[model samples]
Target: MSDTALGKDRRFPFGLTIATLIAFAILIGLGAWQIKRLAWKQDLLARIEVLKTAPAQPLATALANAQGRDLTWTRVSVDCAPAQPATLPLVYGIRDGDIVWRATALCRATVGGYGAVLLDLGVVKALTGQSAPAPVALAAPARAVGVLMAPRQLGGDREATVQKFAAERPAPYILMVETATPVPPGVTPAPLPAEISNRHLEYALTWFGLAVTLLFIYAAMLWRKMRS
Candidate 1:
């Protein structure tokens, strides 16, 4: 009820006590968030393990059976046998009204039947006056690993889109690879590139703990001042 109670808190004892409690709550929240992160990371690791161990299946079969589960964590690599050279209709990253570089790997099955992976190789920077990287020469049993991404129907000039042959480019049923590993004929496949963001859990704990800590400190001080 008095101006003294609402004044800018400058008293050493009170200020330090409040600040210390706030800092303690922050630290506690951080530690708890990290604990939750540990659980999430463990789950991701388990998913990766399953992808690697599960028997490789046809891309169609895999896509059809997926019951709304995140297919991005599900790694599938098909042995592609590209005969000569081909490109598939793909999404390109454009900047300043010019196509910067192709993000989608427009690829074709070399031999008869094999699945293609949308490889997310580093985008080609144009400032250096460079061109798109030459399509890698895929040898027999080419391997690729990434979560199976459902392809988008990018309806545009079928010819204007990136591809080696127009005949190969229909409404593409593409495989979206998260972190791609191209195991060309001779080389072996690499582990999935790990990328995990951890802000949600951090914020959750911070907000919840702040609410709790503020309530406690406010209650304690109210009781102290009243009793005094």
Candidate 2:
């Protein structure tokens, strides 16, 4: 054999091939994981849609029975006006800071007195100054539509959320307001950010494409060496 033949054929880089294969494996694994996540997310979305359309029951009823029970597929209603800005803080957020938000507090329906109240039924863009003072007469009664979420009752847990309004009720998270419309005293509606993050699907497809390319390249390299 010639001196050059005995020498390593740099073109057939075994170490480089091994490293590329490892990288390919990791990317392929990540792509597979993303696919699994997509399945899980779809199921969750379906569950939420079902909950949205379920029959609307009384908040008090749902609370009494649904509390500590399986509440995945239940719904309810609450009636109460947003507490005054002083008492029930109409909390709102600005680009810089947040102040009391406009509210359509839900009070449990009755002849008189307050009933399960969830405030802030109106929407307002914060102003430049210190949490611009809300309209003194912003009495928009919001007939908000939402899911009968488990009330967020305060407890001893350190990480638990504490409400600024009346003392903690059964479940601290009273309800997850799903829909809202403007009434006379409209409370500030909660901002609902989008749930779809499509980039993962794109990345997963990319990794799969790269893995396919690697397979072809490996085969082509082997064929060329055999031909030589």
Candidate 3:
């Protein structure tokens, strides 16, 4: 036989080829998905930063804009009716790199269209046997400037939540007290972060790197099989 005879008639392993192709395609798809997520995360971060710096919007105007949308971090201000406090549950806050518990309360809106809105009076360190601080006493009408946020939703218990806040219309959102004009005594503003972490880039790289490793491994296996 000619020296090239050994090279001329070897058939590729069709099954192995197909399996390798499928695996490569799936890995590539995962990598591409991560890249798309990276872009989306960047855009979300930019939007959040802009929202943070834009001038504080009036409660009414902000409410109108936030309706039927995610209004989590929009800054808003309003001259509100005195906030009555209720000790329902403990909301957490961070201080000095440690998780700290703060007392949370509901601030019912007494103004125009925003009426019935529940503003979370800023958290405090003191709690009176109910994991919540004593009720905040506000003079009849008070002015509050803060970021609007959604109240914490409990998991899988829609009926329980409906029954819990029965007396309140609980606006589509809640206010995180940033500052009370005549600052409420003992309550500290729950400062919102200027920007949130965007880790999508790192995640994307990990997924892509894994895809590349898989490609190299498949290529090596094929080369070894063909040579042997």
Candidate 4:
């Protein structure tokens, strides 16, 4: 009740503690989210590995089972007895550590989903500076074997751009050809990643470390305030 008693009474830093606690809670939540992401990434990589190495099956069979499942990088083969080819759009692709603009083509699948599928025929090599590579002649092959992939969405004017190359506007998918002989000359297949990145563990550790450091700072501040 006296002045000395009031001065001796220690008051909790309620505002500072609440703010620190909120920040700590957010950091912990982020770390937990990253952990969940880590598990998801691991599962995705495992599934991709299995699909890549699994025996090649009919394109129709793969397409049928692709519903509600990621069929990316799956090896598929089709007879494609009467394959028709048309150049899609010119896009830049990497080849042998060199950035080169490669021409992509579309092959109308007669057997599988009956949808037109895009094919990365090969790299366009220009001997003359600023000159474009000669277009590869399209040919119908007896059989086509490759990895099925989803089509990339164009940034602007999607419908017009897609329709220009893809007249049939087949299934929204493409196939990076692994082996389709007697179709085009001087065509090399584009490379795909063997494994996807899984960096969630590092991110989770960073968030957790931040939370721990915050806790230590908060504790030190409280101790100093109490002593004063």
Top-TM-score candidate index: 4
Worst 10 residues of 1 by lDDT: 183-192
| Most lDDT-accurate candidate | 4
**What TM-score, computed on C-alpha atoms, does each candidate reach?**
0.42, 0.54, 0.69, 0.71
lDDT of 1 by residue, 22-91 (tens): 7767767766777787688778677767876675565555555665555655555444444443343323
Ranking by TM-score: 4, 3, 2, 1
Query: On lDDT, who's better, 2 or 3?
Result: 3
Give the C-alpha lDDT of model 2.
0.50
Error of 1 at 161 (Å): 14
- Model 1 vs. true fold: TM: 0.42
Q: Write the per-residue lDDT of candidate 4 for residues 1-228, one digit (tens) a residue.
A: 676765655578888999999999999999999999999888867766686677878777877777767666778876654646644555554444566654465556653455655565555565222345554445545566777666543223333444665556555556667777565555555535433579999999999999999999999998987876
lDDT to native, each model:
0.47, 0.50, 0.61, 0.66
Report how far off residue 96 is in candidate 2 (Å): 20
Model 1 spans > 4 angstroms off: 1-12, 77-104, 108-117, 120-188, 193-228
* Model 2 lDDT at residue 175: 45
Candidate 2 residue-wise lDDT, 115-179, digit = tens? 34443344444522445554444432335455533233211221122243345232334344555
